[model samples]
Target: MLDFYTNPMSRGQTVRWMLEEVGADYQERLMNWGPSMKGTDYKKINPMGKVPAIVHEGRVVTECAAICAYLADAFPDAKLAPPPAARHDYYRWLFFAAGPLEQAVTAKSFGWTPTKEQSGVAGFGTYDLVVETMEGLLLSRAYVCGDAFTAADVYFGAQVLWGTRFGSLPSLHAFTDYAERLKGRPAYQKAKARDDALIAEGQAST
Candidate 1:
């Protein structure tokens, strides 16, 4: 069985969305910040003492990108990842989001844009370059791997949605339009409602 360890306000929300998308039967173990997440017991699940860790069939998976990819492959019936033979764009965009896209937006969050010389050494080049590149790709296609939605959307789209909402990313038409499409999905709504309720419950208790 799949055992998911996460906090509602964390990146785990994306994994939860993937879980719903796959229609997997999993047990959720909610955790809080500080000692609840950093204690020895939880550390065994993730040495980093982080949320968004999963154990399936006794194999542990951490990191949002890896977890999303693993779930897609583990439940092949979900069709979240394209078949091995047809995954050039799938793999490309997935890792691209995990690496350059993440770095670019994070750097922007801190108000750091690499200069021309510095950009050569920065993994994401520049935030504008990353943003323009992604905007171009979305304009050319419906989803990361093209017309059909995939697990790539869960990870990458979450970044776009969160980034746009929190001002880390510009409210470009491509991003807002794509986020609206993802928000309309039944699985996305179910996962979001669960996390939203969790957040509200924690707030009420505090």
Candidate 2:
């Protein structure tokens, strides 16, 4: 069984959603921020002191996209990922969403506008470029890699959902339609509902 270390409100939600998608049997070890993550204990799992780390077969997997991709490949029966033949696009968009989209959206959200000189040196290039590129690609397909729903969609779809919700990306027909399509997935809804309930409980307790 996989050991999942997570916080209800962190990027761990991405892993949680992917675990549901792959239908993997997993154990959840919830960790609180600060002490639980910062102290000596959790640092043994992830030196970065981040949530959403998973232990599978005694190996630790960090990063939300990597964790999701790893599980999709590990559990071939789930069919969450494409076969080795279709790996090119599968790997392509997965990293694209993680590297470019994640950094771009985060920088933009925090009002960290970069100048042309700074953009060249930064990882995301520019927020406008990232948003336009994403809009162009998603507009051309029902999902990132194509029509089929793969683990890539789980990452890209979540980004779209976040971008749309936070007013970071344009609420174009492409984004809206893509979100509407993902809305019908039972796993997505189940994962989201579970996390939302936990978040509500945490808030009430505080």
Candidate 3:
């Protein structure tokens, strides 16, 4: 069985949704933000002391995007990944969401808006460009790679969903419509319900 280490309030929720998407039978090891996550035990699983790490068949995987890609590939029956010819867009948008998009959201949250000069040096260019680029991509297709929903959608959709919720990304029609379509997925609903319950349980324990 897969051992999933996570904290509901963290990026772990994204991995949880992916697990459900792939129909993986896994055990969840919920870690707390401070003591549980910072301890040596959890640290060994993810040296960064982050949640959303997974140990599957004795192999360890960390990072939300990596986990999503790994799970999709590991379970070929799920057909979450596209053919080699289509992999360019799949990998492209997945990392785009993980890298530039994440950076822009983090910078905005910390009120660290980058100047044009700084954007030139930054990997994401400018925050406006990041948002506009993402919007244009989604505007052109139902999914990142076109009409088909692949593992890339799991990562990109989660980013867009979180960005829209926290007001980091604009509530553009393209973003909102895509996010709504993602939410309609049964796996997403299941993951959300499970994580919501876990969050409530954690709060109660505190």
Candidate 4:
């Protein structure tokens, strides 16, 4: 069984959703933000002290996109990834979301808007460009790679869901429609319910 280390309120939710999608049985180890996460033991799993790390077969995987991709391939029966020949868009959009999209959203959250000249140097080019590009991508299809929902959607959808919720991304029709489709998934519902309960419990204890 896989061992999942996560916080209810972190990117861990993204991994949890992916796990549920693949129907993988995992043992969850909930960690708090400070001592529990920054402690030496947890640090061994992820030296960066980030949540949503996973240990399986004695190997550790960190980062949300990596974890989602790992789980999808690890459990091929779930068919979350497309075959090699047709995976161009799959890989493209996945890394795009992980790199440029994440950086743009995070930078915006901190009010660090890049100057037009600086945007040229930035990996994302510019925040508006990132948003518009993603919007165009989603506008073309139901899922990231097309009609078939792949592990790429798991990562991309989570970003859109979180981005829209936090007001980092606009609630355009494409984003909302895609998010609504993702929300309708049973796996998504289950993960959200589980995390919601955990969040409530943590709050009550605090």
Candidate 5:
């Protein structure tokens, strides 16, 4: 069985949506922020003490993108990923969305502006480049890799949702259109509804 450790409010939701997409039989261990994660036992599972870690096939995988990729490979029957022949774009867009886009948006959200010289040397390029690159790819097709939906979409779509939520990325017509399309998916709807309800409950208790 696949073991997934996560907090519903975090990036862990991305992996949860992927698991739902893959229709994998798995178990979820929810870690609520403070005490559960700080314990030594949890640290052994994920030293970073981050949510969205997974243990599968005797290997522990951390990070949302990595877990998504690993699940695609682990459950070949789900066909959540492209075949080996079509893997170039698959890996390219996956890591691209995971790294540059996520980093750049997060930095912008926090109001951090790197120096001109520093920006050129940084890993995420510039904010404009990040937005333009994503806009170009998304404006071209319904999904990232042409017509079919893949695991890359899971990561990319999540990043887009988060970026838009935090007001980091532009809420362009194309982005709004795409997000609507993604939300139409049953898995996305299910995961989001559950998380929303959980948040509501937490707020009520407090």
Candidate 6:
């Protein structure tokens, strides 16, 4: 059985959506912030002391992007990944979203912009460039990996969804439309509802 360790409000939501997409049965071990997540016991699962780690078939997978990719490969019946022979764009944009795009978004959230000189080594170049590149990709196709939704979309779509909603990324038309399309997915809706309810329950008790 798949064992998922997460917090409702954390990036764990991304994995939850992927799990739902792949139709995998998982036992969620919700870990709150601070001690619950940082303690020695959980540390063995993820030394970084973060949420959204998974133990599947006795193998531990952390990092949202890796987990998404692993799930797609693990449960091939979901067709969440393109066949290995046709993964040019699939692998390309998946890493694009996980690496440069992710770095750019985090830089934006931290209110940091690398100078022109700094951009050379910053990896993401500039946030505007990263944003524009992503926008151009989505404007050309229905999904990141082209015509069909793949596990890559779960990670990429989550970026657009949370980034646009929280102001980390600009609300451009391409991003707006892309986020809407992802929101309509049953897996996305189901996973979101579960997290939303958890958030509400926590608030009520407080």
Tens-place lDDT per residue, model 5, 86-136, is: 888889999998889878987887888778898888888888888999898
The TM-score between candidate 4 and the true structure equals: 0.98
- lDDT (tens digit, per residue) of candidate 6 on 1-206: 99999999899999999999999999989999989899999999999999899999999999999999999999999999999999999899989989999999889888899999999998899999999999899899999987899999999999999999999899999999999999999999999999999999999999
Stretches of candidate 4 exceeding 4 Å from the true structure? none
- Candidate 1's residue-wise lDDT over 17-110, tens digit each? 9999999999999998989899999999999999899999999999999999999999999999998999898889889999999999888878
lDDT of each: 0.94, 0.87, 0.93, 0.94, 0.86, 0.95
Candidate 3 lowest-lDDT run of ten: 107-116
Locate the minimum summed-lDDT window of 10 residues in model 5.
159-168
- TM-scores for all candidates: the values are 0.98, 0.94, 0.97, 0.98, 0.95, 0.98
Q: Write the per-residue lDDT of candidate 3 for residues 44-109, one digit (tens) a residue.
A: 888899888999999999999999999999999999999878799999999999999999888888
Lowest lDDT sum, 10 consecutive residues, model 1, at: 105-114
What TM value does model 1 have?
0.98
RMSD of each: 0.8, 1.3, 0.9, 0.7, 1.3, 0.8
lDDT of 4 by residue, 1-206 (tens): 79999999999999999999999989999998899899999999999988989999899999999999999999999999999899899999999999999999989888899998999899998889999999999999999989999999999999999988889899999999999999999999999999999999989998
Model 2: worst 10 consecutive residues (lDDT sum) = 161-170
What does the lDDT read for residue 179 in candidate 4?
Answer: 95
Show model 2 residue runs off by greater than 4 Å.
none
